[model samples]
Target chain A: TQLLEQSPQFLSIQEGENLTVYCNSSSVFSSLQWYRQEPGEGPVLLVTVVTGGEVKKLKRLTFQFGDARKDSSLHITAAQPGDTGLYLCAGTQTGANNLFFGTGTRLTVIP
Target chain B: DAGITQSPRHKVTETGTPVTLRCHQTENHRYMYWYRQDPGHGLRLIHYSYGVKDTDKGEVSDGYSVSRSKTEDFLLTLESATSSQTSVYFCAISELDNTEAFFGQGTRLTVV
Candidate 1:
């Protein structure tokens, strides 16, 4: 069983549309992070949320950490073709050495 | 991107053959990790090394082994390759000061 579950395994939308992806878990985490992976490339870190109820924005991307630290969400505004890629959410448990990653959500934006 | 390199960027090996993938880092970070990415699975950790001669398993450790003999290099070996093992593998390094990790380009392995 996956410790973290991400919804909308795949998404296809037109450019300029908005979309949101979610990651949920039953266990609380000390820190959570989001990453984007493109074809033929390794995943790159997008943002990290450490505190519960924290919100971070990177240009057109917005990330939110749940108050209980058990869930998180990513919202994209006016999505563009360049934003298409696999989105992954990972969480690090307290006193743990490895981060648990969620099944990714593949997004495709057509211009 | 941090100075991390994965060898054999692309490989095609037969099943039951032994394959070793190497990860070299110039950052000399204390932590090194191996992860595989698949269609449904985003990125599952196979193994990680904390320091020289120190290693541990991750969520997906079966059918794989890792060794860290030096501070700058980590090796992942598959004793017997399987078709299911065909995937893109990534190497990452992390420092003690922060949780942010730097990932290598990746190695695409195919088992026939």
Candidate 2:
């Protein structure tokens, strides 16, 4: 099993604060994806990083894949109250489409 | 918003009873997956179907079974429900195995 571990299981920050969430794994993956889920809703895809050491930005969110494809990080600049939700990192193995999801990071941005 | 829907949005059943959840898709995607979400665990894949009548087990498939008879429908069954099986279930679809998946709203199951 490819285990993905996420640090800072929970984060509470003020609006406009900057924060980063990390996902680490010992097994390498071909691609990694970030998803955001709110209460009573399914997870929504944020970004997918395929190449190693790649970075993608979506508005205030910046996602980066590790050089070895075994880790990833998501950084939010000037977080807003609407950013309060659960962030999950999922990795797809080199030859598989089944995604392994990390434990998750619950972020609460107080306005 | 990929036109995915799950039936019985909320269900409550006694342990040992059989329960089935249905997923319907309008996009005619070839891949369909069943997942269960708990508090600490993000989401566990129960089963997945590559095509009609072609299914495979996932990481967490022991207690669950799935069947897809038509192109647009996938059903997940819990042969004998248990309290531990109480969780929110989500169904997702994708055109390709490695593509972005579209998820249904989800079904909340409660096994007493």
Candidate 3:
């Protein structure tokens, strides 16, 4: 069973548009990370969030950890064609070493 | 990009045959993991190793076994291949918990 769930399994948008993807779980997490995967390649790490309600920005990409530590969100502003890929969220629960990955969101940005 | 490499990027085998996938890392990271990706199921952990000769089973361990005889190498074996096992397998390595994981390009396996 998948411990984490992600919303908007698929998204398609034009260039300069905005989009948000969500990852949620019932179990609390100690830390959560975001990754982006392109075709024929492995997922690359984007950012890691450790604090609840804390937000981090990577250029036009913004990531936020839920205040309850059971959810997270990723927002991309001015989406570009280069932003098209699969977005994944992984979390490590307290006292656990195995990383539980969430269902992925595939984003397609058309130019 | 993190000096992690997976061999046999693509493979096709018949059912009931045995296959092994190799994951090699030059970074000497302590943690290595094997994951299989399928539609809707996302990425499911098959097995993982924390050090040489120290390994553990993950969520989907059926018909799968792993060996880590050396720090730089982790191997996953399928005793007998099946059509249900066909999926893209990924290798990930990390030096510590709560840190970034470096993944290999992934191996596309097909069982016919």
TM-scores, chain A, per candidate = 0.98, 0.96, 0.98
Q: Compared with the true structure, what per-residue lDDT tens digits does model 3 show for residues A35-84?
A: 99999999899999999998999999999999999999999999999999
Cα-based lDDT at residue B88, candidate 1:
93
lDDT of each: 0.93, 0.93, 0.94
TM-score winner between 1 and 2, please give it. 2
Interface RMSD of 2: 1.5
**If scored against the real structure, what TM-score would every candidate get?**
0.96, 0.98, 0.98
- The order by descending lDDT is 3, 2, 1
The collision pairs in model 2 are none
lDDT of 1 by residue, A48-75 (tens): 9999999999999999999999999999
lDDT of 1 by residue, B73-98 (tens): 99999999999999999999999623
After superposing candidate 1 on the true structure, give the runs of residues whose Cα lies further than 4 Å from its correct spot.
Answer: none
Clashing pairs in 1: none
Each model's DockQ? 0.63, 0.66, 0.80
Preferred candidate (lDDT higher): 1 or 3: 3
lDDT of 2 at B106: 94
Superposed Cα deviation of residue A73, candidate 1 (Å): 0.5
Residue range B1-112, candidate 3, lDDT tens digits: 7998898999999999999999999999999999999999888889999889999888899999999999999999999999999999999999985478999999999999
